[model samples]
Target: MSANGLVQIEGLTPPGNAHRKTSKVMLLFPPEWVPTAPYLALPSLTAVLRQAGHEVVQKDINIEMYDLFFSDTFLFWISGRLDLQRRLLEERERRAALTDQETDQLALLREKCTVEVFDLAERAAEAKRIVRSQDFYDADKLEWALNIFREVMQYISAAYYPASLVFYPMESNLGYRPGVSREVFACLEDEQVNVYRDVCRQLVLPVVNREQPHVVGVSIGTQMQLLAGLTFCKMIKQAFPHIHVTVGGNVVTRLQEEWPTHPQFFNEIFDTAILYEGEHALLWLLEALAGGRPISSVPNLMYRGTVGVETNKEIYTEKTTALPLPDFDGLPLDQYFVPERILPYLATRGCYWGRCTFCDHGQGYFDQYRGVPAHQVIEQVLALRDKYHCRHFLFSDESYPPALFKKVSQLLVERNAGIKWTTLIRFEETLQDQELWYLAAKSGCCTLYYGMESANERVLNLMDKHAKKSVMRTNLMQASQAGIWNHVMAFYGFPGETRDEAEDTRRFILEHQPYIHSVELFYFVAYRHTPIVRSPEKFGITIHKQPEYDLPLDYYYTLNEPGGLSCLEAMEMAEQFYQQDFHPWAVRVNAREHVFLYISKFGTNRLPQIYAKPEDRLRGTDSVSGLVTWPVALGEGDGNKEDGPTMTRVVSHASGG
Candidate 1:
């Protein structure tokens, strides 16, 4: 509405028959998710919808967007686009002295225009080939291939000037605050920086026109995906008014309370939002849309009622045992950015030990815990393996329980499923048995990611982790001895953790460097749904609320008495740790998937070839301070892992898929 004549998206419901029968459904996984593998949400929801006799076409636009970024056609198109921008910027400059922002934009456009598109495109294609072939095992080739992706991403980012787009970690910023609803609406229609608008026009709308589906569902799993996912929804609603657009995912569930306040979201963006555990909820919502049942009867749904937007009172949780196996029929499984097909199979919903005070992962679930039996899990894993012709699996469970872990390991050994897999688990006192680690390794368990949040017992108790140092050390030693790659996740700050306690964690990782294969360190964030935020006094912190961030899932805060490390100190300590203490964990391969493949191929965690060269390590030591810092790529080490079954939500565990 500001410069372009796009209508202000408010109070304008598309002319769709909301209660029309829905038969065919097109589900979309939007951009900014890790492109290494297909997110489990689409397949999970597709299985449920198809089981109900509905025609479903699941599309992973995230991977498609990445795949498009490195293509000759797209790169050439980008070059032309940059040239056009250059001409327009020059025209503006001729009229008057260019503003600072405009000058910078023009410079970026000019720089991008000079790139040899043909050469770049050829190298880009080769890079993709290297990653998907036997050449992927060569460490140098793989590193070059990954760097090529980052280079392409840089070029693409320049084309969309002012928006900082990135390839890995899915941390692309569109220069808009997604937590601010008004900015979100503006970002949806902005043609200048909103690359997603172009993405939708080129990739999404054409499919909608061809498929002519009755419903289009977009899964938004993380805060990083919010802008892109909502852009798809609003665009789909605008282009095909007859197709009801819906959204569901971990992010949606987290923002459920914030959504109803903005009724325009329901009126213009999406017709409905299905909250936590969407398998059965989505199926029933489709039935309601088809007029087979009352709209009010649909559970875990937020819809536009006569009064305004209304959330259904009922909550529905799927019975893990009765659900159909995830259907990956419509997904482009081979197109993932990996040499081998890695399928994510979730055996559990929600964390079994759901006691982390600073974690809000439990809020994404209607039920605290629900897991399929060990035999059932084995059957499903084997079934998925055979059906997909895949030997690698990611058990995307939230903190795999000790009992289930042991039983599954034993079963995998018994059946000799011959599948290499990994998952997230705790340092359980019950799992200290050496035989368990041996059995797990024999069953093709290549790596295990642990949430070793702290090394000091006091801090652990405060975080409700309750993990003992002795138990953690024993587990790591046993896992390493059994040839399992051990990746530990720790944070710098809890509410009252002092510098000494944070040092205890750093010292622990340093002392146990041989046992720990990788480490991900992060500063703490007080999420909106965590117990600390609900009762700030209990954690001795003051929550600072910003009026502009209407849809915030996390908050800024200050310690009440300032005895412990302040937030700024926490940030500095984390940075210092990464800069000074990064040498031991800073390997040539940083991505968890890449590390896992190495472990599986080499049959040991002692991967000397993956380490940085001696010169590189020495260079790190000679940096601005004590050592050189390695550029870490966050594949599965983001430190904010989500529960597996919450529809494509990713967590910080080392299981990338």
Candidate 2:
């Protein structure tokens, strides 16, 4: 123990339980559903637990699981064959145009065939020893995940029908951003399911037998993580009858407010559930468990008993300023893998302007926003830098309240905190304070990720996103002028958007190409219990109904009524927009050296000329051959018919106008 005579923070030592002798806690990091990036949440939570005088051991099941599924040589061979089959199916679809009735029937048949193929893909992916055999895998529960994936795919595919055709696009939200190939999806799904099952077996069983802690806590983020957490909890209870299990994470926090009261929920897993920010709720639950007190008094806990779930008072306590900064020393720093080891620090919780209709923060769970004191933030940064040698800091605030950002920026400057950072901020707020931007740059702010959900004013209004498109554009331009990289987060296929609106978004991207460094897009997923999900009819969309306990990873609905794009058509349009406009722009901008050379040779004036005749421009004899023709005058009789008067004026006017 330290000088304070508390329990020494070290390795896993089971907690104090009445029935179990050894007391240990195991913290698990779930598999990567979106990207194969390093797990940070587990390490951060481990740091917090260690600081609280609890011995914590973390297991990143994602990496191990990924390796087990993808690294097998035999599986690659099988996956290649699956890809060939999928291509054949696509080719067949392209070669024929069926009547609407025939199209509907064929779509159903195609869905069935795809489901069967996915099942085989999942099995082949899990064929390795680390995930399948009893020695490394749980023999009885191995098929549990395979079954779940098969059912989820079938259910979601059937529910959404042809509309979900765009589920796997060429580019996605993951870091790799490669086309969603059939083989790749098979490989990823296999890895996700296997990792979850294997980790649950290894971690949960060990904790159950050797370290039956008072509570088994699972952290969830994505749908895959939620499934794994629930399955693991079920297994834990089966193995150790007396132990109670709990779950808390972003997914859980979002779901628990209007948490469904299905029988499957109580019969399947988890004795108690914690919703929203779990630090305080978990601490209170642990205290009650250790003191042998009743669980009903525990705030923010949903307890499941013989009768039903008994939820305690929803806690909305004031944010504690004195909460200690997460201690990173206890975690395996070397094992942590990200594109960059971005040390995450949250200056606040919730959003200052939580008005977005689709955002969970504006809902019941995360309504309050709180900021940490600037002095404390600086101190934490100093500790992170000195102790862990961190270089890049990722501020994980909901919106990084502008006032707090200003204070923190000033403190960083005052304290000489040499830390490079990136954060999420509101465009309107950034425009409101230029001094904050100046100070932020002085304090090593490298990038600002701005939320501009849609460029169309009507779409933004429907989504309850308060910021105007005009303000967003102006702020983005100013941010570029301030020498800060701007990453725009956009969404497509909101309920009321039309094909025309999507076209407008595409146009907006082209018009403001200079300011946006990168773009991230997500197709809307109607989350359960949200106002959008509950009252989608009011938004002029039909909500597809699914089974009570069934939560689909890619749940979507169609805006088939008057003012919206049909779900399938909207998705196809969005995909086309990405491929035709957004992606090409990203490719051009990201090729920095090439873009620089082009700009230098042709000047900005020649950009329109190059874009107009891309085929000819690309076929130049050499790089210099392309550069030599920049000053050529285009008279009205010039053979460039595609270069209309409007194009010529756009090119010429920019030179002076």
Candidate 3:
């Protein structure tokens, strides 16, 4: 039976003799998946397999590609190309001729060549210097490191693909939408423009084919990874032909829900696609595959069947707290693009307040909120600390549960678990407690990112964000005062939101600039099946020309009213906001440099006097090393003149840099 008929059982095809159980599995995180650290899925899955006693190997191809692409050897090769082009251009001019197009091209190259050549050489020099320098992680040197990295990546991209090839937050120009299926397919087969494909061919396929793992898993955690993820999967399937391939992550989970129409497109790339909390689901499927058993027993999976395509019962009720700690064993800890190793750990799963209208917490992507016990979480932390000598951690949760965080902080106090971390947090009433704020800071919560989608009360209500603008303001202030770096996330273009809300948000950021160290502004993209999309009328909006999708893609949105802030307008506002110096503390919404920035400044739970002047702000410095001295104010160090936290400059022989 096809899409029109009753589902039959014939389509199910198990891996043939070519995919015989080798008991070895390889998990890959493709290029542009992430820049700084590896996404959590690969490690989580790898850890599960390792615990289950399966031979597993995992590698972050993004970081490997980063190392190779940014090497001096690569830069020299590019320099050679530029030099050859110069010679060829002169020789051609002397040899009597140039076509109009060739003349235009030569002129453009000549105009840009000197600057490009010099810039590339300078970027190379800076990179070589910073990588070898002792103060590599210092703010200034790190910025130098990032600049050179950006240049090298740009060089690669301009030469082939037009992708940004960023690391801090994975970004790319490759198509990720449902309509781009054919484009993605072409990209996979194209060797000329597909840089990510080239990356997989050089770094991915060889290692994968060498290991010849029976199962290959790819994690498409974000839209940024979608295209490359699909491309990588295509390469694997084409090369091996019989290796079982599966994909899971937020993107896959959401797509499976909205377009349950088992996109045979997905079938072409993946044998099975796992959704939701995948620990048990993935493990069960692997167990079945290895044992040569029928896969119907596995839950939360979609597999193509002979009769038709089908999905198994969802992994709806797994208690995440009961799951084992995520293992980061097989990852390359040293090669990440960051100066300090920032490992990811999740204390909880899903958003506690699942009512945000634009958010899809209810959509199978998010779990019904739950948290692991503080002690169990700490045990894992200690183990990871031992295994990977890194103190920085990023809590990869939708919203870091305030209660769980406080509990974890108290435990960190009782037992000295010295790890500094940052995470996305909700600004709710619970944060009114000053003690909670203090405890969070003392427990090494370096930054708390607040989702202040809008600062206008009406916009907040419209989005069903639950928290008010006042609450957001107060929470930010308290968090900042508590010695935590408050990072704000703002998005405009909520259906009913207009200039009023946009200005209100801008005003709030300006008013509380000291409290906010960064702002991640986004122009809202209405996704399918979310509350906004399900009932556009409720928000007085009319979605126009919405095409029925065989695969999941979020578009088909229009404002009911005339000439309002469309996505483009909102984008313009965000660009203006970023370009202008709207506040005293530099609002960095572009890169993940703030992680190292904060580490280089505040080493512990100490109060550095908040500087009101932008000039006093520190960017990169070598002096921060000495600031890692004794405890700031130990326990109950709130406001006592003697024992309380006191403001002081880093007070070191910090150079101007």
Name the top lDDT candidate.
Answer: 1
Highest TM-score: give the candidate number.
1
TM-scores, one per candidate? 0.92, 0.64, 0.80
Ranking by lDDT: 1, 3, 2
Clashing pairs in 3: 10-306, 11-305, 11-306, 11-307, 12-305, 12-306, 35-167, 139-620, 140-620
Estimate every model's Cα lDDT from 0 to 1: 0.80, 0.50, 0.61
Q: What is the lDDT of residue 327 in candidate 1?
A: 95
The sequence of per-residue lDDT tens digits that candidate 2 reaches over residues 1-657 is 334332222222234543422224565555533211233455555554655566655655554443333333423333443355445546666888555754664555554545444554455444333222332223233223323333433333332233221111111122211112232223233432233334556544764577546667777654434445565666676777677677776656555633445444545566677765565566556656665445665556777756777677545332437556665554444432222234556666556776666654333244355566777788877887777776567665656666677788888888888777766677673454555566777777766666676789888788776667777787777666655666565656778887788767767777888887555443555655456777777887777765432433224577656766676675566556544454323221121112222233332212432231344334432122111111111111000001111110111000000
Model 1 lowest lDDT segment of ten: 639-648
Candidate 2 RMSD to the real structure: 15.0
lDDT of 1 by residue, 1-657 (tens): 324332222211123534435489999988877667777888888997887678998999988998888899999999888899899889999998789999999998888888988999999999999878878889888768877887888898898889988755456788998889999989998998999898898889999999999889998887777889999999999998889999998889988999989998998999999988787777777777777777887778899999999988777766778889999997888888788888888888777777788877766676547788999999999999999999888777768889988999999999989999988888989988999899999999998888887899999899887889999999999999999988887777888999999999999999999999877776777788888899999999999999999999789999998679888887788778877777766666545666778888889999888766667776764311112342222222111233221111123422211
Clashes counted in candidate 3 amount to 9
Better candidate number, 1 or 3, judged by TM-score: 1
Error of 2 at 210 (Å): 6.7
Candidate 3 per-residue lDDT, tens place, 1-657, comes to: 334332222212244634434368888776554456656777777666666667888878767777767666665665565456556767888886776755654664454455565567666656645643555545566555655666566565544422344433343454334245555566666664567776787788999889988888887654556777888888888888889998876667767754345364556777888876566577667767877556786767877767566787534445565556667776777666555777877666556776777765434443355667778888878777777887877666667676777888888777777887776677787768778788877887776666677788887788877677677778887787787876566766777778776888888888887677655555676666568878888977776643344444465577878645776787677656644533343322123333433543556323233222234234322122211111111111000000101111111000000
On the 0 to 100 scale, the lDDT of residue 321 in model 1 is 88
lDDT for model 3 = 0.61
**Regarding TM-score, does 2 or 3 come out ahead?**
3
